[model samples]
Target: MIKTSGLSYAALAQAVNRLGYLAGKTLNYSKSAVSRWIAGEQPRNPVPELLLEVFRKKLGREFTYRDLGFDIAEADIEIRSLWYSDLSTTLDVAPLMWSHDVFRRDLLKSSAVAVGAMTAPARNFLPFEPDRCRSRTGSIPVSLGDVKMIREVAHQYWRWDSKYGGGRFREQLVYFLHSHVAPLLGGRYGEKVGCGLFSAAGEATMFAGWMAYDMASLGLAQRYYTQALRMAQAAGDRQLGGEILTCMAYVANSAGAPDDAIQLCEYALDITKGRVPPRVQSYIYSVLSRCLASAPSSPRNRPAALTALNAAERHFARPLDGSENAWVAGIDFRGLQTQAAHVLSELGMTGRAHEAISVALDGRDESHRRAVAFCKLYLGMVHVKEDDAEAAVAAGDEVLNLLPGLETARVQQGLARLQREINSLGDTDPIRTFNERARTLGDRS
Candidate 1:
């Protein structure tokens, strides 16, 4: 692989560090470390995933751990097949993945897993039979009532994650997964109860995955989401599967692969067409718009962005029969408008972006403190585009005030971008003042 890619050990180390930073981790492997790996000592959990990513980009092909001579004879195929494991197999792996995440396994720390490996799960589910997931149990006994309790607990975790941040209770979800849910999967049950149990576990896994995403634990998030997608498909919950696909899209876009983001979003839309709640459709479309707008430098991407933005708005404004799932219950017109504003900003339509951003900022819910902080940064960017330095600083300052104790990757990234934009305004007093403040705050992070 190195012979074809012509990448040196130092370059490999640099690429690993860059990926580590992007994943919000501190994987600073040295040039000697790469040399050691090349000498036949297998790289650890997330390290293998990262190296595969480097060679993938350098050679433009997909590579696996086996290609790197890693011994997988003792590895769990179910966990490795996280994208689309079968019912009992998926249940077996979900608890283990949570355990790995709780323990911070090497696999959980390497965010590069999502770089190329996430797409196949959605494709795997395209022709999935959610019913064939039922399986025979071993010893103890599980009841439908037990499944209900799992669902209830999962919902509570979701609410906590929503009101506070995922940092507040993400670990607790893993605890529940390990302590309560794992044993139940080993318990005895009929087909009906089996499906219900898997569905309940999927709920917990999905919520836990989203919390990981919110807390910016990228590798863990990828592990959880891929497992959750398998669980969702196993239970025949197409809606939940689509939701998992959408979450994957968010991670894809964040990792600078807009094409992966677009693929996942489109897959979600394709699988759930006319079958999902309108609000869910709105959420998917809104995410799709963001992915499209991100690539607006291309003529094709610009019109596609506009089209997706319009579609999201239309879907958001569609009537609901009040049967929306609890997961998408918070995806309202307000969030739609906020994303629309960002898309417009990405498209370089300053007037429309400013107008949309202002609408998003107005009548905002204080409960969504993070959203408010992000929108403020968006406002600052808009002010920058309009050459209003004073207004931009005011908007940026508001963001700082709202930023205490919140260090999510998205928040830190937006802050960094805002700092760069402010610095570009030269050595003026206000710009310099804000730049220093932003730089200081950024350094602390």
Candidate 2:
């Protein structure tokens, strides 16, 4: 297994220790401990659990004690696939996914391919028939206070992800969800409590998904999002359900499936039934417009894009009534304009795109390095579109400066894209210099 991951035992031990630290454990793991395990002694208590995560993340699948040469009993979950019709099965699986994901970092090694993963999950999202409840009641009596705690924790994590990149906080967030929240599922609760529990857990799952998305692990994000969708449906949280679908739409858009993106957004709108707050509605419309504009110009859904964009603008123009869903707390004017800028640029509205993006860029929080990088890249693209070589070079340079400490694949890809655009402006000194640096953006070492 070490050979497969191309890691020495020392390196693997180090990885395990780092992940454990993120889980708030204070332990020093020596290479000899791993050697002792190889000599037929299983790691004591939490070490084995941590080791399992280390290897599971090293390889993108579950592992056993035997697989890693540790003499320990195997703990497995009966539920695995998201295709299961029973929401209870999904609830059972959420913790399983969270356990693996908490310390699992291998998924970030590549951009997960998005093909048909969401189809099964989204089908389940469409106003489905409720299944017989199968929650196994535990000793702890669930309460609204517990639900509120989960909601608060999930909201706090969202703010963290918005400020720091997901790569910075996903491990800690997943650790809380898996270690703290998952155990609650086994404790006894009535249907009402179950709904609240699932709803809160679903938000945690969505946060996990969003973090993966921020890291550019589209495929892993899909798995988490799929579970989130099922959990929300079981809880009958319609607003959250729509938010999950919209998240899927964002993934689809990034994965080069613009038409699929548009379809998913429409499905979300259908389920929302105008029940979402006006701010949330505007967010939904803004994303839909971005998708429509992303399609190839020949068959681009411009008419639909225009309608969606207009709706977004109209809704955004309304004052905040403090009635918006908590899940969409950051979906304000700047976020709307970010999508609008992209749509307008795609529609050949260069001047308006430039103005919109400039404002979006100016309004971005410096703590949100990932988003700041994206705005800079898009701003560079707008300059390229307007045939301003000097301006494009300047925007590209600033964005390049921001990329050194960021570890996100989508951001790197955007930089590569900006480089390509720069290349088309002829091989001048600024273009050539920017192009070379951009090529190194994907250098992992």
What are the TM-scores, per candidate, against the unseen true structure?
0.79, 0.77
Tens-digit lDDT string for candidate 1 (376-406): 8888888888878888888898888776656
The lDDT for every candidate, in the order shown, is: 0.76, 0.73
Judged by whole-model lDDT over C-alpha atoms, candidate 2 comes out at: 0.73
Candidate 2, residues 1-99, lDDT tens digits: the string is 777877787887887677555433456877887788777777665576666666666676666667777666534221132332355556556777777
Clashing pairs in 2: 137-188, 138-187, 138-188
Give lDDT: candidate 1, residue 88: 50
Model 1 lDDT at residue 202: 80
The runs of at least 3 residues in candidate 2 whose Cα sits more than 4 Å from the true structure, single-residue gaps closed, are 1-81, 103-114, 128-136, 297-300, 436-445
